[model samples]
Target chain A: MFQGYTAAELTSIFAMQGFAGLSLFSVFVLMALGLAIIFGQMGVINMAHGEFMILGAYVTYLTSNFFSEHLSSMFSLYFFVAMILAFIAAALLGALVEWVLIRHLYRRPLDTLLATWGLSLILQQGYRTIFGAREVGVTLPDWLMGSYAITDMIEVPVNGLFVMCLTILITIGVYLVMQKSRLGKQTRAVVQNRAMAGAVGINTEKVDRFTFALGCGIAGIAGSAFTMIGSTGPTAGQLYIVDTFLVVVFGGASNLLGTVASAFTISQAQSTMEFFLSGSMAKVLTLLTVVGILMLRPQGLFTLKIRS
Target chain B: MKKLQDFTRNPDAVSFAVLAIVLVFILPTVLEIFRLNLVGKYLTYAYVAIGLVLSWGLGGILSLGQGVFFGLGGYCLAMFLKLEASSPENTAIQSTPGIPDFMDWNQLTALPWFWEPFHSFGFTLFAVIAVPVIFALIIGVAMFKRRVGGVYFAIITQAIAAIMTILIIGQQGYTGGVNGITDLRTLHGWDIRTDEAKYFFYYLNVALLFLVLLVACWITKSKLGRILVAMREREDRVRFSGYDVSNFKIFVFCVAAAFSAIGGAMFTLQVGFMSPSFVGIVPSIEMVIFAAVGGRHSIIGVVYGTLLVNWAKTTFSESFPELWLFAMGALFIGVVMAFPNGLAGLYTSYVKPLIGSIRPLLKERARLYETPDKGGPDMLNRGTAQ
Candidate 1:
C-alpha cells in the first residue's frame, strides 16, 4: 500500500503512529482494567461499566469548570484535581450501587447481567436528562493542549503523552495495590476462593464492594482522560464498551498485565488499519480479528488460575 | 375441531384459543382506526419480544442478536416496499427515477446486486423470513455448539448486533442508513395509507401474534422444549443423554429468527417505515428488558412487557423527552432488582388464586378426562413448533 512516501517521511509516520497508538492503548487499558476486576473476579457481568466511565467523565467536566471559573490561577493543576475528583465521585457512586443493588445480586450472577444492563440504561438516561442529549466538550488546560515535535514531520499531541504517563502511573498503582498491599492480598484471596476467604474472616462482601468501586473509579479516570480525545455524551461510553470488553476478555480476565498487553495489541492494530482504511472499516476489521481469536481461544488470551 | 387437543400441554391455551376465535371474528370492526394502529405496532414488538422470551427468557441464552434477525427481516421487507414504490408503472416512480428521496440526496446509482430479488412480493416475503432464519441458524450453530453461555454468549451477540448496526449505517445507499427505509407506497397491491389497509395490517399483526404465541407455547412444552431447558441447565448432560444440544440450539435460534422476522414484517407494515436504529443494540436490549420485565419464561409475559414498555416510551417521551430514557432505565433496573418474577409473576402470586377459586363455576367449559380437544398429535412434538 505504500507508494509515494520517502524513507524520511515513512520514519516520521511510524514515529508519530507509535505515540497515537500508545495513548489509545492507555485509554483502552484503563477501561478494561476496571471491567476485568469486576467481571473476572466476582463473576458478575457489570454491563453498566461504560456508564461508570461516563460518570467519571462528567465528574472531570464539572471539576474542570469549577477550576476554570473559581480558581483560574490553578488551571494547569486543575486536571490533576479533576482526575482525583472523578475517581472518587465514580467510586462513591459505584459503592452506592454495590451496597444498594449489586449486594443482593452476587447470588444471582447471571441476573446481575440484566440488572446492571438496565442500571446502565438508567444512568445513561439520567445523564441525558440532566445534561441534555447533545455532547459536551471538555476543554484541556492550555499547557496540555499542544503537541510535541519529535522530527521535522513527526509531531505528537502533548495530551497523548499525558495519557500515556497517566496510564503508566495507574498501572503501577493498581499493581502495587494488588501485589503489595493488604487490600490486594485480601482481594486476591477472595478471587482465588470465595468460601475460603469468607471462612478466614476476610469479609468477602467488603472486598466485592471495594473491588467494584475501585474498578468504577478507574473507569472515571479513563473517562476524564477520554474528554481530551472524544465526545462526552450520554451514549459516549457505548463507543468504548465493546473495545473495552475486547481488551479485557481477549487478554485474561482478572489479569492486569494481560489487559494492558491486549490493549496495546488491539489499539495498535486498529490504529495501523486506520492508516490504510476508513475509520469504520478499521473498527470492523479489528472486531473481526478479535472474534476470530476468541473462536479459537474462548477463554481469551490469558487463562488465569481460577478460569479455564 | 379435533386438532384442538394438540394444545393440551399449554396451560394458557384455552384462554388464548378463545381469544383468537373472538379476535378473528370481531375485534377489528369494534376497535377504532387509531387504537387498531397502536395495537398493531404493539403486536409486532410483542412478536419480537416473544422470540427473545423463548430464546433468552426460557432458554437462558440472553441473546443480544435479535436485532440482527429483526434487521434481516426489516431490510428484506423494506427492499420490497422500495422496489414496489420505485417501479416504472408505479405512480411514485413515474415522477422520479433511480433513487428514493433519501438516496437521491446521497447520489446512488443502480440498485445493489443483493437487492435484486425483492422486486417480487413472493421473493420478498420468503426472504424476509428466510434471511433472518438462515443468519440465526448459522451464527447460533457456530456459537451454541461451542457451549457458549452467560456473559460470554451475551457479549458476542452484542458485538454482532453492534457491528451490523455500524455496517447498515455505513452502507447508506443500500440501507437508507441513519434515516432507514421510509416514505413507502404499499405492500403487494394494497395501499398502505388507507385506514382500511391500516386496519388490515393491524389484523395481520394480531393474527401473527396469536399464531406465534400458540407455536411458542406448544414448543416450550414439547420434547424439544425439554431439551432446550435441559441444555440451559446442563448441555453436557443432555448431550450425554444422546441428544445433539447444538442442533436444538440452532433450531430454537432459527425459530426465534422466524418469529422476529414476522415481527419486523408486522412492524414495517404498521409504521410504513423501518430504520437502522430499529435493529441496533438499544432495540435488542429493549427486547431483553421486555422479556425480563414481563417474566422471561412466559409468552403472556411477553405481551404485557411489550405493552408496558411501548406505553412508557410514547407517554413519557411526549411529556418529557429527556427524562423518558432515564425513567425507562430506572424501570428496567427496578423490575429486575425488585420484581424478578416481573408483572406476570404478580398475577400468578395473586390473581391465579381468584381464577382457581372461581374455576368450579366455569366447569362447563373445562372439559373432562384431563385432555383437550381430542386425539390429534401433540402440537409441539410435530416440529420446531415455536
Candidate 2:
C-alpha cells in the first residue's frame, strides 16, 4: 500500500495518521472509560451509554448558544461551564435511571441490555423532538479553531490536541476516583460482594446509584469533547455505541488502563487502515478482528487473577 | 396415526395446530392478497423469533446477530433470482448482458466466481440453508467451545452483524451495495411478481413455517430440551452432570440459524428483494424484541408477537411517524420489566384462569340437564384431567 510513497512522504503520512488516530483514541477512551465502570465494575450493560454522551453534546451545544447570545465577552470560557452542566444533567438522569430501572435488573444483565436499548430509543426520540432531527454543530470559540502545523505536510488541529489533553486529565481523574476515593472503595466493595458490603454497613444501593451516575457523568464529558471533532445529532450516538463497547470489551471490561490501551490500539489501526482502504472496509476489518480475538480470548486483552 | 395421536396429546402441539389452522387456512382466505403478502413478510420474522425461542429462550444463548443468518439466506436466494432475471436476452442492452445490472454499472464484465453457484436453483436452495448454518456453526463452535456466552456472546454477535452490513455495503459490485438485490421477477420460469404467485408463496411460506415449528417443538419436548432448560438455570450443575454443554449450544444455534435462513429466503420471494437493511444491528436487535415480546419460550406466542409488533409498527409509522418510536420504546420497556414472559405469559396467568372458571360453570349448567345423574363421575374425570 505504501509502495508509491518516498521514505520522507511515508514518515509524514505515518505521523499525520498517528495524530488522527490519537484524536480517535481520545474519543474511544473517553467513551469506553464510562462503559468499563458500568459494564465492567457493575456488570450492567448500559446500552444507552451512547445516549448519555449525546445528552452532554446537546448540553454543550445549548451552552455555546447561550454564551454566544448572552455572554459574548466570556464566550471562550463557556466550554468549562458547559462541561460541568453536562456532567450534572447526565449524572442526575443516570441516578434516576439506576433507581427506577437498573436496580430491578441487577441480576439480569441481558435484560438490562434490552431495557437500556429501549431507554436509548426514548432518549433519541426525545432529542429529535427537542432539537429537531438535523445535526447541530457547536460554534467553537476563536482560541480553539485553528490547526498546529508540524513541517510542510503534517498539520494537526488544535481542537484535537485539546480533546487529547482533556482525555488524559479525565482518564487520570477516573483512575484516582476508582482507586483512591471513599466512594470508589465503597463501590469496589459493593461490586465484589453486594450482600457482604451491605452487611458491613456500606450502603450498597447508594454506592451502585452513585457509581452508575459517575460512569454516566464521564460519558457526558466525552460527549462535550466530541463536539470539537464532529457535529452532534440525535443518531450520532448510535454510530459510536458498538465501537465504544468493543473498546471496553476488548480492553478487559473492568480494567481502566486496559480500556485506554485497547482504545489506542483500535483507533490507531482503524485510522491507519482508513488511509489505505475504504472507510467502511477499515471499520469492518477492525471490528472483525476485535470480535474474532474476543472469541478466542473471551477474558479480553487483560485480566486480574482473581477467583470467581 | 399413533404419531398423530401422540402429537395431539401434547398441549403445545394442540395449540400449534390451532395456530397453524388460523394462519394457513383462515388468514389467507380472509385477508386480501396484498395484506396476505405483508403477513408473509411478518411470518419471515417469525422464523427468527422461533429460532430465538430455541437458542435463547431454551438454550440460554442470546445471539444478537440472527440478522446475519437472515441476510445470508435472503442474499443467497436473491442472487439466484437476480441471475435468472439478468439472462442474456433480458439484459441485451447492458454492457455485461448476462451479469446483474449493478455489476454492469460498476463496470464489471464478468460475474463474480462466488455468484456463479447461485445460477443453479438447486445450488441456491442448498446455499440458503447451508450458508447460514455453516456460519452459525463457525461462530457457535468458536464462542461456545471457549465458554464465551451471555452478554459477551451478544456483543460478539452484534459486532458480526455490524461487520456483515458494512461488508455488503462496501462490496457493492458483488453484493448489490446499499440498494441490495432488487427487481427479482421470476422463479424457475414462473412469474413470482404476479398476484397468484404471491398467494402461492404465502402458502409455501406458511408450510415451511409449520415444518420449522414442528422441528422446534420436537427439540423443545425432547430430553435435550430439559437439558437446555437446566443449562439455562445453572450451567455448572448441568456441566457437572456430564453434559457437553457447548455441543448442545452449538446445535441449537445452528438450528436457529437454519430456521432464520429459511425465513430470509421466503422474505426475498414474497418481498421480491433482499437488502443489507435487514442485515444490520438495528434489525437484529428488533428481531430479539419480537421474540421477547411474544414469550420467548413459546413458539406460537413468538409468531403472534412478530405479527402484532410488525402490524403495529406499520400502522403507527404510517399514521404518526413520531409516536411510533415512543410506542416501540414503551413496548420494549414494558415487555422486559412488567411482563417478562410477554403476551403468552399474560395469557397463561390471567386469561387462562378466567376461561377455566367460565368453562366449569358452563359444564355445570350442562350437567344439570343431560348428565345430572353422571355428575359425580364427570367431576372425577375432570379431577383426573387436572
Candidate 3:
C-alpha cells in the first residue's frame, strides 16, 4: 500500500502516525488503569465505569465554565483545578456506589455487569438532562492550542504532549501508591484474602471502598485529560467502554505493566492501520486481533503464578 | 378428578395451558392485526430470552453477543427477500439489473459472491438456522474449550457484537449500511404488506415460538438439564464426575444460538427489515434483561417478561421518553437486588400458594356431590376426607 512513498516520506509518515498513536496510547492507558484496578484487583465488572469517567468529564466541563466566567484572566490554570475537582467528584460517587450497589453484587460478577449497565443508563440520562444531549467541547487556553514543529515534516500538537505528560505523572503516582503506600499494601492484603485481612485488623470493606474510589478517581482524571483531544457527550463515554475493557482484558486483567504495554501496542497498530484502511476498518481489525489473541491465550498476556 | 389434581399439581402443565391459551386463542381473537403484529415482534425477542434461560440461567454461559446470531439469521432471510424484491425486471433501469439496489448505488455492477446463494428460498431458510448455529459453534468451542468463561467471555462476545455492527454499517453496499435492508416487499410471491399477510405471519410467528418453547422445556426437563445446573453450581465437581463440562456448555450455547437465530429470522419477516441497530451491544444486553425480569430460570416466565418489558418500553417511551431509562434502570437494580428469581419466583412463592389454599375450597364443593369410588387417587382430597 505504501510502495510509491519515498524513504524520506515514509519516515515522516511513520513519525507522525507514531506520535498520533502515542496520544491514543495515553487515552487507552488512562482508561485501562482504572478498569484494571476495579476489575482485576477488586473483581467487579463496573460496566458503568465509562459513565463515571464521563461524570469526571462533566465535572471538568462545569469547572471550566466556572473558571472562564469568573477568572478569565487565570483561565490557563483552570485545567489543574478541573482535574482535582473531577477526581473528587468521581471518587465520591464511586464510594457511594460501592456502598449501595456494588457491595451487594460482590459475589455475582455477571450480575454486577447488568446492574452497572443499568446504573450507566441512569447516569447517561442524567448527563443528558443536565448538560443537554449535544457534544460539548472545552476551550483550550491559547498556550495549549497550537502544535510544535519538530522539523518541517514532524509536527506534534501541544495538547497531545500535555495529555501524555499528565498520563505519565498519574501513572507514576498510581504505581507508587500501589507498590509503596500502606493503604495499597492493605488493599492488596484484602484482595488476596478477604477474611484473613479482616481478621488481621484491616477493615476489608474500607479497603474495598477506597480501592474502588481510587480507580474511579483516576478515570475522572482521564476524563479531564480527554477534553483536550475529544468532545464530551452523554454517550461519548460509551464509545470507549468496550475498547477500554478489551485493553484491560487483553493486557492481563491484574497486571498494570501489561495494561500499559498492551495499550501502546493496540494504539500503535490501530493508528498506523488508520492511515491505510478506513477508520472503522482499522478499529475492527485491532479489536479482532485482540479478541483472537485472547481466545488462544485466555489468561491474557500476563498471569500471576498464584495457586487457586 | 385425578386429571384435575395432576393439572393443578404440575407447574409445567399449568404453564403449558397458560401459554397455549394466550398464544393460540386469546391473543389472536382479541388483538387487532396491527397489535397482533407488534406482539409477534415482541415474541421474537422471547426466543432470545428463552435461549438465555438455557445458556446463562442453566448452563452458566452468559454470552453478551446473542445479537450476532440474531443478526446473522435476520440478514440471511433479509438477503433472500431483498434479492426477490430486486428482481432483474424490477431493476432494469440500474447499471446492474440483478444486483441489490445498495450495491448499484455504490457503483457495483455485479452481485457479491456471498449474496448469490441467498437468491434461493430453500437455501435462505437453511442458512437462517445453519449460519447462527455454525457461528455459535465456532465461538463456543473457542472460548469454552479454553476455560474462558464468566466476565472475560462476556467482554469478548460483546467485542464480537461491536465488530459485527461496525462491519455491517461500514460495508454499506453489501450489508445495506445503517439504513439496513429496507423496502422488503414480498416473501415467495406473497405480498407481505397487506393486513391479511400480517395476520398469517403473526400465526406463523406464534407457532414457531411455541415450537421453540417446547424444545426449551424438553431440555430443561431432561437429564442434561440436571447436569447443566450442576455445572453452573460446581463445574469442577461435574468435571470430576467424568463429564466433559466444555461439551455440555458448547451444546447448550449452540442450542441457545439456534433459538435466537429462529427469532431473528422471524423478526425480519414480521418487521419487514433487518438492521445493525438490532444486532448491537445495546439490544443484545436488553435481551438478557427480558430473561432476568421473567425469572432467568423460568422458560415460560421469560416469554411473558419479553412481552411485558417491550410493551412497557413502547408505552413509556411514547408517553414520556425521559422517564423510560429511569424505569429500566430501576428495573435492573430491583430485579438483581430484591427479586433475583424475578416474577416467576414471586408467582411460585406467593401466588401459587395462595391459589393452592383456595383450590381446596373448590375441591370441597366438588366432593360434596361425588361418590367415594369416583375420587380415584386424589392425595389432597383423600387427606382432607380422612
Candidate 4:
C-alpha cells in the first residue's frame, strides 16, 4: 500500500498520521481515565460515561456561547472556564446518579450496564430536545486555531497540542489523587474490601460517590477537549462509549497506567492503519485485534493480582 | 386426548395456551392485515428475545451482538431474494445484467462468490441458520474457552457488533452498503409483496416463533436447564462437578445465535429489507431489554414483552417521538430496579394469586350447588384455605 511513496514522503506521512493518532490517544485517555476510576476502581460500568462526557461537551458549548454573547472581551480564555464548568456539572450529575441509580446496583454489574444505558438514552433525548438534534461546534478562539510546522513535512495543530496538554495535566492529577492523596487511599480501600473499609471507619458509600463524581468530572473535561477537534451531537457520545470501555478493559480495568498504554496502542494502531486503509476497515481491524487479544488474555495488558 | 391432558398438567400450560389462543386465533381475527403484519415483524424480534432468555437468563451468557447473527440470517435470505428479484429480465438495462443492482452500479460483472450459493433456495434457507450458528460457534469457542464471561464477554460481543455494522456499511458493492438489501420482491416464484403473501409470511413467522419457543422450553425444563441455572449461580461449582462449563456456554450461545438468525431471516421477509441498522450495538442491546422486560426466566413472557415493548415503541414514536426514548429509558431503569423479574415476575407475584383465589372460589361454589347439604360450610372453609 505504501510502495508509491518516496522515503521522505513516507516519513512525513508517518509523522502526520502519528500526530493524528496522538490526538486520538489523548481523547481515548481522557475518556478511559474517567471510566477506569468508575469501572475499574469502583466496579461500576457507567454505560452513560459517554453521556457524562457529552454533558461536558454541551456545557462547553453553552459556555462558549455565553462568552461570545456577554463577555467577548474574554473569549480566548472561555475554554478554561468551560472546562471547569464542565467538570463541576458532570461531577454533580455523577454524584446524583451514583446516589440514585448506581448505589443500588453495586452487586449487579450487568444490571448497572443496562440501567446506565437507559440513563444514556434519556440524556441523549434531553440533549436533542434542547440542542435541536443538530451537531454543534464551539467557536475556536484565534489563538487556538493555527498549526505549527515542526519541519517542512511535519505540522501540528494548536488545538491538538492543547488537548494533549490538557490530557497530560488531568492524567497526572488523577494519578496523584489515586496514588498519593488520602481520598485516593480511602477509595482504593473501599474497592479492595467494602466491608473491611467500612469497618475501619471509611465511609464506603461516600467514597464511592466521590470516586464516581471525580471519574465523571474527568470525562467532562474529555468532552470539553473533544469540542476543539470535532463537532458534538446528542448521539456523538454513544459512538465512543464502546471504544472507551474497550480501552479501560484492555488496560486491565484496575490499572491506570494500563489504561493510558492501551489507549495509546489502540489509537496509534487505528490512526496508522486508517492512513493506509479505508476508515471502516481500519476500525474493524483495530477492534478485531483488540477482541482477539482480549480473548487470549482476558485480564488485559496489565493484571493486578487481587484475590477474590 | 392423553397428550392434551399431559400438556394441561404442565406448569406453563395455561400461559402457553393463552398465548397460543391470542396469537393464533384471536389476533388474526382482531387485527387488520397491516396491524397483523406489524405483529409479525415484532414476533421476529421475539425470536431474539427468546434467545436472550436462554443465553443470558438461563445460561448466564449475555451476548450483546445477537444482531450480527440476526443480520447474517437476514442477509443470506435477502441475497437469495435479491438474486431472484434481479433476474436477467429484471435488469436488462444495467451494464452487468442478472447480478444485484447495487453490484452492477459498482461495476461488477459477476455475482460475488459468497452470494453465488445463495442462488439456491435450499442453500439459502440452510445458510440462514448455519452461517450464524457457525459464527457464534467460533466466537463462543474463542471467548468461553478462555472463561471470559460477564461484562468482558458483553463488551467483546458489542465490539463484534460494531465491526459487523462497519463491515456491512463499508462493503457497499458486495453487501449493499448502508441502505441494505432492499426491493426484495419474491421467494421461490411467489410474489411476497402481496397481501396474501404478507398473511402467509405472518402465519409462517408465528409458527416458527412457537417452534423456537417450544425448543427453548424443552432446553429450560430439562436437566441441562437445571445445570445452566446452577452455572449462572456458581460457574466454578459446575466446573468442579465434572462439567466442561465452557462447552455448555458455547452450546447455548450458538443456540441463541441460531434463534436470532431465524428471527433476522423472518424480519427480512416481512420488512422487505435488511440493513446495518438492525445489525448494530443499539439494536442488539435493545433485544436484551426485550428479553429482560418480558421476564428473562419466562419463555412465554418474553414473547408478550417483545410485543408490548415494540407496540409501545411504534405508538409512542408515532405520536410523541421525543418522549419515546424517555419512556424506553424509564422502562429500562424501572425493569431493573423496581421489577427485576419483569412482566412474568409481576404476573406470578400478583396476577397468578388473584387467579388462584378466583378459581378455588368458583370451584367451591359449584361443589356447594351440587351437594348443598353435605358441602355446607366445609367447602367455604376449603375455598378460604386455598
Candidate 5:
C-alpha cells in the first residue's frame, strides 16, 4: 500500500496521517471532556450525554438555516455563530435537565443510568418526530469548506483544520476556566471532597450544576463541529456517544490530560486500523481491546478513588 | 393433618399447580382466545423476568446482556421452525428452501455454515441454551473474574451487543441478516395454526415459568443464594469469609443466561416471529427497566413486573403512541427517583399498610384469607437474605 512514495513523500505521508489523527483526537476530546466532568466528577452516569450533544447539533442546524435565509452572504461565518450558539443552547438544556430530572436522583447512581437511557430514547424519538427520521445535511460555509494543501505530496482537509482549531480554543478556554478561575477552584475542591468543600463554603450545589452545564456545553460544541464530518439525525449523537464513553473511560474520567492522551491513542489506532482493515472491523477490534484492557484495569487507564 | 396442611399451604408448590392447571385446562376454555393470548404472552415474560431478577436483583450483576441471550434462543427456535416449515412436505405459504426472506433480498442461495445445526430441533434447542451461556461464560470469566463492576461492566456488555448486531447486519448472507429468522412453523411436528397448539405453547410457557420460579426460589433459599446476596451487599466480607466472589457471580450469570434463553424460546413461539431487535440494546435496557420497575430484589415481583410492563407497552402504544416515549422517560425517572422498589416495592411499602389498616374495618372476609399476589415476599427468606 505504500510503495509509490520516496523518502520525502513518505515523511509527508506520515505528516498527513498525523494531521488527520490530531483532528480526530480534537473531536474525541471535545466530546469526552464534558462526560468526564459529569461521570467523573459528579459520579453520575449520564447516558443522555450524546443527546445533549445532539441538541447542540440541532442548534447549529437552525443557525445555518437562519444564516442561509436571513444573512445570505454572511453564510461563510455561520459556523462561528453556530459553535457559540450551540454551546449556550446545550448548556441551558443541560442545566434545565439537571434542575428538573437529574437533581432528584443524586444518590442512586444506577437509577440515573436507566433514567438517562430512557431520556436518550425519548430525545431520539422526539428528534425523529421533529426533524424527520432521515438525516439532514448541514451546509458548510464555502470559505471553511474543502482542504488545505500542505505540500505537493500531501493534502489535509480544510474542515479538519477548522475542527482542530475549535477544539484547541475550547480546550484552552476550559483549561483557563478550570485552572485559573475561582469557579474552577471550587469545582475541583468539590470533586475532591464534596463535604469538605461544602464546609469550606464552596457552594458545591452551584458548582455541581455549573460543572455539569460546562460538560454539556462542551458536548454541544463537539456536536456543532461534528456536523462537518458526520450525519445530523435523531441518532447522530448515538454514533459518537459509545466511542465518547469509551474514550472517557479509557482516558480515566477524572483526568483531563488522560482523556486527550487516550483520545489520540484510540483514534490513531482506529484510523490506522481502518486504513488496513474495514471500518466495522476496526471498531470491533478497538472495542474488544478496550473491553479487555478495562477488565484488567477496572479503574480505567488511570485510577482514582482510594483503596490503592 | 399437619403434613396434609403443610403440603397444601406451601404457596410455591400450590401456585405452581394452580397456575399450570388454569393456564393449561381452564383459561383457554373460559375466556376468549384474545385474552388467553395476552395472558399467554405474559407467562413468557414472567419466565424472562425471573431470570433477570436472579441475575440482576439477587446476584447484583445488573446484566444488560439478557437480550443477547434471548436472541440466541429465539433464533435457535426460529431456525427450527423455518427449517420445518420450508421442507417440501409442508405446502401452505411456502418459503424458498434454505433462504429466510431477508436472505433472498441479500441474494443468498444457500444456508450459512453456522446455521446448519439449527435444521434439527434438538440441535437448535441445544444451541439456544448453549450459545448464550457459552458467550456469557467466556465474557464473564474474562471480565467478572478480573473484577470489572459498576458502569464499566454495563458499558462493555452493551458494546458487545452493539458490535454483535453490526456484525450480524454486515453478514447479510448468513444469520438471517437484520430482518432475522421469521415465518415460524410447526413445533415438534405439530402444526402451530391449531388453537390446541397455541394452548400447548401457552401451557408450556406457564409450566416453564413455574419451574424456573421454583428453581429460582430454591436457589435463593440455598446457601449459594445467601453468599451471592451477601457478596452483592459486601464483597470484602464474603472474600474474607473464604467464599470466591467471582465464582458465585459467574454461576448466577450462567443461570441467568439459561433462563433468558428459555424465555426467548417461549417468546418466539408466542410472538410467531423473531427479529434482530430481540438482541438489540433497547430490549436489553428494557429488561433492566422491567426488573427495576418491578422491584429488582423481589422474585414474585418478576411476574408482576413483566405483566405490568408489557401491559403498559400495549396500552401506551395503543392509546397515545407519540407521548409514550416521554411517558416512558418520566416512568423511569419516577421509578428511580421516587420508588426504588418499583410498583412491587410501592405496593409492599405503601399499599400493604393502607390495606392492612382498612382490613380491620371490613371484619374478616374469610376467617383468614391467604395473602394475594405478593404473599411470597418472605417465602425464600429474601428480606433476610439481603
Candidate 6:
C-alpha cells in the first residue's frame, strides 16, 4: 500500500493517521468508559448508554444555542458549562431509569438488555421529536476552530485536541472516583458483595443507583466532547452502541485499563487501516479482528481474578 | 400408532389446528392478494421468531445476530435469482451483459467466482440452508465451547450483525450493495412478480411455516427440551450431570439459524428484494421483539406475535408514524416487565383462569398448558449469582 510514497511522505502519513486514530480512540474511550461501569462493574447492559451520550450531546446543543443567544460574551466558555449540565442531565435520567427500570431487572441481566433497548428507542424518538431529525452541529468558540500544524506535513484539528484533553481529564476523574473516593470504595464494596456490603451499612440500593448514574454522567461528558469533533443526530447514539459494547467486552468488562487499551487498539487499527482499505472494509476488518480475538480469549484483553 | 395418538392427545393439538385453519383457509379467502402478500412477508419474520423461541427462549442462547442468518439465506437465493435475471439477453443493454447489474455498474466485466455457483438452482436451494447453518455452527462452537453466553453472547452476536451489514454494503459489487439484489424477475422462468405467483408463494410460505413450527414443537416437547430448560436454569448442574452443555447449545443455535435462513429465502421470494436494512442490528432486534411479544417459549405463539406486531406496526406507522416507535418501545418494556411470558403468558395466567371458571370439568380435560414457568425465577436467581 505504501510502495510509491517517499520515506518522508510515509512518515507524515503515519503521523497524521496516528493522530486521527488518537482522536477516534478518545471517542471510543469516552463511550466505553461509561459502558465499562454500567456493564462491567454492575453487570447491567445499558444498551441505552449511547442514548445517554447523545443526551449529553443534545444538552450541549441546547447550551450552545442558549449561550450564543444570551451570553454572547462568554460563548467561548459555554462548552465548560455545557459539559457540566450534560453530566447532571444524563445522570438525573440515569438515576430515574435505575429506580424505575433497572432495579427490577438486575437479577435478569439479559432482560435488562431488551428493556434498555426499548428505552433507547424511546429516547431516540424523544430526541427526534424534540430536536428534529436533521443532524445538528454545535458552534465552536474561536479558540477551538483552527488546526495546529504539528510539522510541515501534519496538522491536527484544535477541536480534536480539545476532545483529547477533555477525555484525559474525564478519564482521570473516573479513575479517581472509582478508585480513590469514599463513594468509589462503597460502590466497589457493593459490586463485590451486595449482601455483605448491605450488612456493613453501605446503602446498596443507593450505591447501585449512584453507580449507574455516574456511568451515565460520564457518558454525557463523552457526548459533550463528541460535539467538538462531529455532528449529532437522534440516531447517532445507535452507531456507537455496538462498538462501545465491544470495547467494554473486549477489555474484559470489569477492567478499566482494559477498556482504554481495547479502545486504543481498535481505533488505531481502524484509522491506520482506513488509509489502506475502504472505510467500511477497515471497520469490518477491525471488528472482525476484535471478535476473533474475543472468541479465542473470551475473558478479554485483561481479567480480574475475583471469584464469582 | 402411539405417536399418532400422542399427536391427537397433545394439549397443543387444538391450537395447532386453529393456526393451520387460519393460515390455510381463512387468511387466503378473506384477504386480497396485496394484503395476503404482506401477511406472507410478516410470516417470514416468524421463522426468525420461532428460531429465537428455540435458541433464546428454550436454549437460553440469545443471539442478537439472527439477521445475519436470515440475510445469508436471503442473499443465497437472491444470488441465484440475480444470476437468472442477469441472463445475457435480459441485460443486453449493460456493458457486461451476463453479470449482475450492480457488478456491471461497478465496471466489472465478468461474474465473480462466488456468483458462479449460484447459477444452478439446486445449489442455490442447498446453499440457502447450508450457508447460514454452517455460519451458526462456527459461531456457536467458538462461543459455547468456551462457555461464553448470556449478555456476552448477545453483544458478540450483535457485533456480527453489524459486521454482516458492513460487509454486504461494502462489497457492493459482489453483494449488490445497499440497493440489494433488486429486479429479481423469475425462479426457473416462473415470473414470481405476478399475482398468481404471489398466491402460490403465500401458500408455500404457510406450508413451510407449519413444517417449521412442527419441528420447533417437537424440539421443545422432547427430552432435549427438558435438558435445555435445565441448562438455562442451571448450567453447572447440567454439566455436572454429564451432559455436554455446549453440544446442546450448538445444536439449537444451528437449528435456529436454519429456521431463520428458510424465512430469509421466503422473504426474498415474496418481498422480491433483499437489503441490508433487514440484515442489521435494528431489524435483528425487532425480530427478537416479535418472538418476545408472542411469548418466546411458545412456538405457535410467536407466529401470532409476529403477525400482530407487524400488523400493528403497519397500521400504526401509517396513521401515527411518530407514535409508532413509542408504541414499540412500550411493547418491549411491557413485554419484559409486565408480562415476561408475553401474550402466551397472559393467556395461561388470566384468560385460561377465566375460561376454567366458566367450565370446571372442561378445564381438567381440555386444558391447554405448556411446560410450566418453573425455570423463570430459577434463571433470574442464576443471573443474580453471575
- Kindly list the per-residue Cα lDDT of model 2 for residues B1-386, writing each as its tens digit: 66975885577867888898899889988999989999999999999999999999998899999999999999999999999999999999998799999999999999989998888889999999999999999999999999999999999999899999999999999899999999999988999999999998998999999999999988998999999999999999999999999999999999999999999999999999999999999999999999999998898899999999999999999999999888888888899999999888988999879978896787577566665565455664777778
**lDDT digits (tens) for residues B94-205 of candidate 5:** 3444456555566666667776777777788788889889988998897878888767778777877776776666565566677777777787777786777777777778
Model 2 DockQ class: high
* Per-residue alpha-carbon lDDT of candidate 6 for residues B91-193, written as tens digits (9 for 90 to 100): 8999879888899999888888988999899999999999999999999999999999999999999999999999989998888899899999999999999
Per-model root-mean-square deviation over C-alphas: 6.9, 2.9, 2.2, 2.5, 6.6, 7.7
Each model's C-alpha lDDT?
0.81, 0.93, 0.91, 0.93, 0.79, 0.92
| Candidate 3 pairs with clashing backbones | none
For lDDT, candidate 4 versus 5, the one ahead is 4
* DockQ values, each candidate: 0.58, 0.84, 0.85, 0.88, 0.52, 0.77
Q: What is the TM-score of chain A alone in each candidate?
A: 0.95, 0.98, 0.98, 0.98, 0.92, 0.98
Q: Rank order by DockQ, top first? A: 4, 3, 2, 6, 1, 5
- Angstrom error of the Cα, residue B92, model 3: value is 2.2
iRMSD of all candidate structures:
1.6, 0.7, 0.6, 0.6, 1.7, 0.5
**How does model 3 score by TM-score?**
0.97
| Candidate 4 lDDT by residue in tens digits, A1-308 | 88989999988888898887877888899999999999998778899999999999999999999999999999999999999999999999999999999999999999999999999999999999999899999999999998989998899988888889889988999999999999999999998888999999999889999999999999999999999878999999999999999999999998999999999999989998999999999999999999889989999999888678
In model 3, which regions exceed 4 Å deviation? B1-5, B372-386
- Candidate 6 collision pairs: none
TM-scores across all candidates?
Answer: 0.91, 0.96, 0.97, 0.97, 0.87, 0.95
DockQ preference between candidates 2 and 3, better one: 3
Clashing pairs in 5: A147-A158
Off by over 4 Å in 1: A1-11, A305-308, B1-10, B18-31, B89-96, B99-104, B360-386
**Winning candidate number (DockQ):** 4
Q: Is the docking of candidate 3 incorrect, acceptable, medium or high quality?
A: high
Candidate 5 chain B weakest lDDT stretch, 10 residues: B363-372
RMSD of 5: 6.6
Considering TM-score, where higher is better, how would the candidates rank from best to worst? 3, 4, 2, 6, 1, 5
